[model samples]
Target: MKVLVTGAAGFIGSHVSLYLLERGDEVVGLDNLNDYYDVNLKLDRLKRVEQHKNSYNFSFVKVSVEDKEAMENLFEEHKFDKVVHLAAQAGVRYSLENPHAYIDANIVGFMNILEGCRHNQVKHLVYASSSSVYGANESMPFSVHDNVDHPVSLYAASKKANELMAHTYSHLFNLPTTGLRFFTVYGPWGRPDMALFLFTKAILEDKPIKVFNYGNHKRDFTYIDDIVEGIIRTLDHTAEANPEWSGKDPDPGTSKAPWRVYNIGNQSPVQLMEYIETLEDSLGKKAEKELLPLQMGDVPDTYADVEALVKDVDYRPQTTIQTGIGNFVDWYKDYFKVK
Candidate 1:
């Protein structure tokens, strides 16, 4: 199958692209290579994909999803069989500082993707949502069936809006849209803005790492490989309308239209302190911690209920935090030449 992957140079995008290529799928990668964190890191990730197996099956283009003309042209030219829309302005705390970026990237960019998929007659549209959408809900394990109308952060709001927009398209055009609400994704080649990367960097440099929510926050840190596996399974299994769905008692996860949402996570929430300790063990260095209150637009905890995902797609998260962190530390040390 021929697939289009937005945010191809990003952390998850890069891995997803490689995974598709490895599975003998033709992939057209797209990314603006924005300096949200480090453009060099993005470039290196792309290089790694290009150097790996099935490199000939992968092609890349530089473009932003918000650019309507560019997106339209690409869609018309490529006519992708499916699309994995992972491109978005990501970061809960950063959304509070620069809200417009979220609007342009997450909102407008997603509009362009939906339009492209709708016109191109794409078979499946698997896009990334967020665990943040379950904002202010103290549910033990965040489930797709739960109402997510109350998102505390603009980032979360933008994701929720994407799900709504996707449902509209699925209803109107009979498009098959599947939204995966990802929990805290981490592993090798992760975003510098993410907790694992930040903590690792700070710890390596003997700097103090800020422990948010006074180290009380719990996160279901899903590994990158597990996430890619779930993504591939979802991409292959196109969404179908739930015949049991009724407007009288509509389910938030499934619709009468060909739209669905699922939580893609490890299904095990670990405390912030425990996560850092795992990292410390991986790096053989102790972190200097500065306990701090939770930042605006941040949730205290996120635990994903991936039962639907497992039942539907046979998705399973196999990596533990210790193993994931150890893999990350090895990659980090090798990539940065850390002794």
Candidate 2:
């Protein structure tokens, strides 16, 4: 299998590329190497992929998904058998600050990916969505079958739009598409903007970590390996039109076309304070507490009901915060040589 994995230099993308390459697949990894976070960290992640097992099978390209001409050319040149679209302008609160960035990278960039997949004879397209789409629903254990019409943040709105756009392509062009709504993914080599990374960094530096929602928020914090597993599983199981789907009672998760959406998350939701405590335990340090109100454009809780994913993929995310955060702390200390 020859796979094109966009955002290959990113945390999840790097891990996914390495996984595919290890399984004897030829992988073409693509990323713009933007400075949204640390470009050095992104470069280091790419190096890890290049040095890992079956590294020869991996080839990386410098490109952004929003660049239509470059994306089209790459698709035509590679003739990719499948695509894993992971590149996006992430960060819920960041979306509030810079809405235009979200529009460019999440919306326009996704459009370019869809066009590339459609024009090429790609077999299946698996892209990342977000748990934030369950915005304003106040529903416990967010389910894909439920309605997601309300999005509090522009980032969430972009994700919902991606689903609608994918459904259209699946229906009109017969393109098999699957969207995975990932929960709070965290692990070693995680993004700097994410909570795990920030908290760890602040704690090591003996700084006060801002506890949002007064440490009342709960999240289905899925591990990075679990997310890669879900991606591979869904990629192998090509999307197919649900025969029993009815227009009278439309299921938002499935369609008459070859389009489906699933939630990829740990079913176990952990409170923010518990998560912080786990991190403190892992790092052997305590964080100065600064309890803050729930930041705007953020959900109070996120719990993924991955029933559809389990039914289809026969897999579930099972990493506990203790092990996950411990692994991250070890990596952080080793990566930075922090005593």
Candidate 3:
């Protein structure tokens, strides 16, 4: 299978590309390598994938998805069996600042992806959605069946729009589109903007980490390995039109067309402070905390209801926060040479 992975230079996208390569699949990696956080870190992830260039099938292209001509040309060149659309302008707080980035990448870019898949006869299109779509919803465990019309940030709004756009394509052209609403994904080679990476860096430098929501927040912190596993499983299992679905009382998760959505998460939400403590233990350093109110476009808690994912793909994110943090700390030490 020739798999096209957008955002292949990103933290999760790079890992997904490697996993596909290892499983005897050809991969065409694409990314703009924009400095959303740090371009060097993104390139470092690409370097790790390049190490497997000998046996595994892998090719990389430096292009943004927003470029309609480049994206259409790439699709015309390679009739990809499957596409993992992981590229997008990611970051909640950053969305508050540069809202146009979200529009260009998440909105316009995703539209291009849907268009390419429609015309090129792609088999499956699996794109990355986020748990941030559960904005302002106080549901105990965020479910795909729940209404997600209220997104606090433009980033979240763009992701929600992606799901809708995918559904429209699936319905109109009968494209198989699956949207995975990912929780807080973290591990080795994570984005510097993410909480774990920032907290770890701050703690190591004896800097005060801003404890958002006064450390009262809880997150379903998912490991990269688990995320990759779920993605592979989903890619293999292309979505199908639900037989029992009806328009009268429509199911939010499944559609009459081959469109679907699922929550990819640990199912267990951990406190923000507890995660910091785990990181501290891993690095043998205590973080100086500066408690602060939650920033705009931020949610107080995020707990994913992954029952649908578990039932469909046997996707159970089993990495404990302690173990995952330890693995990340080891990688950080090796990557940065922190003595």
The segments of candidate 1 whose C-alpha lies over 4 angstroms from its true place after superposition are: none
lDDT of 2 by residue, 1-339 (tens): 999999999999999998998889999999999999999999999999999878888899998899999999999999999999999998999888889999999999999999999999999999999999999988788999999999999999999999999999999999999999999999989999998899989989889998999999999999999999999999999999999999999998899999999999999999999999999888888899999999999999999999999999899899988988889899999999999
lDDT by candidate, in order shown: 0.94, 0.94, 0.92
Name the candidate, 2 or 3, with the larger lDDT value. Answer: 2
Alpha carbon lDDT at 307, candidate 1: 90
lDDT by residue (247-269, candidate 3, tens digit) is 99988899999998999899999
Q: For residues 45-68, write the lDDT of model 1, one tens digit per residue.
A: 999889878999999999999999
lDDT of residue 206 for candidate 1: 92
The TM-score between candidate 3 and the true structure equals: 0.98
CA RMSD, predictions in order: 0.7, 0.7, 0.9
Task: Give the clashing residue pairs of candidate 3, or none.
Answer: none
